[model samples]
Target: MPWAVLRLHRAALAVWGAFLLATIGMLVWEAGINADSVRDRIAACGHDPGLCRIRAVVDYGGTIGWASTLVYYSFFAVAAFAGGALIGRELENGTAQLAWTQSVSPTRWLAATLAVPAVLLVAGGTVFVFVFRWAWAANRDLMGDDWTFNDVFAARGPALVAYGLCALGVGALAGVVLRRSLPALGVACGVMYLINHNLEKSREDLWPTVASGGSGGQFHPESHYWPMHLVETGIVLGVAVVATGAAFWVLRRRTG
Candidate 1:
């Protein structure tokens, strides 16, 4: 059993989890204490009688929620570092072939290794989502004319998980094909970052929609369906799965 994967995943969560919690706690606390200022700001922005209201408005509620989501995304970086090191380091030390020589087949090895970090990712996501829902519920109506917690939490949350999975897949693929861990780590990290760049570019910039007919009118950014974000996220997860399968097939064939 490649215990390295489990260790890597735990380390990623232990280290990154603390950071994520700290950031969220502070923001939530800030929001709670500063509710008055936040409310005033929201009222000010909402009362504006302007032409073509803006979408990217940040209110206290949005601020609290945004802070949580931003910290949640920091998981991607943690996953890249830990996931890359998982197989990449083994391949670097030239000990990865040792797996093939052992009774454990390549497929089993992949499953065991991948499971470790996958659990960590899920745990982290679960915590984030729970906290996000709470924060959103608390601040929902007070969220402001142009800000939204849904935008901050839902869309970006899944994307972060997909990114982590892709990073691990990158490491595995590199190990199987190149048999060198450091190079694999570098390549995987770089490629995932590049993909993330594109994901960001294509990411829909959504905000609350303006409430119509009212004298002052409610305003929000052009909101999007949260489920639609699954499309790109699924695409990323698909690439990671394909790459992983190919790596396993190639490695097993080589071993046999």
Candidate 2:
């Protein structure tokens, strides 16, 4: 069953591999070559104290920021693939029915369909998150990012993996409910987008804001960001579990 699943999704696996390689390559370049260049510019500016060479650093930061943005938003692609390729296409073309008749239980088929992609998503997302974290922290002077930034928040920790898992769950639910490729793809993407958007907006509320001075002064300590991120990760993971359970339940009802 695993081999058959692998064979069926070889194209997606290849694409995922290529994306992972490209992201890692970009991070390596940013952390190595671009970081060196930024450091050199900083040193040169310090020595001269006249020519401001900080624009170069900012430009490089912008480039790295764009690359990281793509990685941060990769869950959308995962959701699309899960809906359009993984389950929807199979059900639409009667392939899932064929598999079911070949001594494969509906539950097992659904499990394989979700499990294989979930593993790959976690592996790929974790690698990108760690690499991007290193690259992002390598030269803080070159970056204008903060913990509150959307892409930074999503790309820096286990939240990235959580988002991928949640997307997969939402996609599975959409595919099972719609049982069509295009509609499932569209609905899944939309649902994931909403989930992400809402979460990003309410992320700060996950943890209470620290009031430093008087009633007029309220600021979030940097130390609180990690805890907030963990809380958000838990929320996303909870969503994933619910969606997955709902998908399985729906599949069982439909098949039985």
Candidate 3:
């Protein structure tokens, strides 16, 4: 059953592998070539406005910024794949039903589908998180990003992996409920977007804000990145668990 699942989703797995490789390559380039060039440019610039305004030096941050943004939002791609390719297409095309009748019980089939992708998602997300954390920290002077930044916060820790797992769960639930590929893809993406958007907005509140001074004081967390991200990760993982359970329950009801 696992082998059949792997065979069916080999294309998706390949695409995921390509994405992982591309992200790793970009991180390596940023940490090596880009970092060195930026350092040289900064040294040359010193206090010279003209040297500081050089295109390569000025644009370095933006170039690497986009790469970080892509890595941060990679969960959306996972959501789309899960909804469209993993579960939805199978249900829409009657492949799932075909498998069910051939010595593969519905629950076991669902387990195989979710488990395989869960492993892949965690592995890929972990790599991105570690690489991104290193790159972001190492190139702090070259970028304008901060711990409070939306993409940076999520990308720096387990929150990124949690988001990917949550997306998978949401996608699976949408696929099972809709039983159609295209609609599930659309709905799952939309739902995940909403969840992410709202969370990004409220993330600061996950941990209490601290005031550093008097009346006109600055308000921020004592530790901005990890604490808030950890809280948000817990929330996202809770959502993933609920969605996965619901998917299993619904599948059992439908098949039984």
Question: How close is each model in CA RMSD to the real structure?
Answer: 6.6, 2.0, 2.0
Tell me which residue pairs clash in candidate 2: none
Ten residues in a row with the worst lDDT in model 3? 49-58
The clash number for model 3 is: 0
List pairs with backbone clashes in candidate 3.
none
Which candidate has the top score in lDDT? 2
Question: What residue runs in model 2 are displaced by over 4 Å at the alpha carbon?
Answer: 42-52
- Full-model lDDT for every candidate: 0.60, 0.86, 0.83
lDDT, candidate 3, at 53: 48
State how far residue 203 of model 1 sits from its true place (Å). 4.0
Taking the tens digit of each residue's C-alpha lDDT, what string does model 3 give over 1-256? 7788789888888888798779778877887677887777667766764656455544865665666678678778888888888889999999999999999999998899989889988988898878877777676667664567777777778888899999999999999999898998998899899999999988777887777766866466536667788889999999999999999999999998
What shift in Å separates residue 189 of candidate 3 from its native position after superposition? 0.5
Tell me which of candidates 2 and 3 scores higher on TM-score: 2
lDDT, candidate 3, equals 0.83
Model 1, 178-245: lDDT tens per residue?
Answer: 66655666676677767666765655432344556757666434354454456666877998898778
Q: Tell me the TM-score of model 1.
A: 0.68
Candidate number with the higher TM-score (1 or 3) = 3
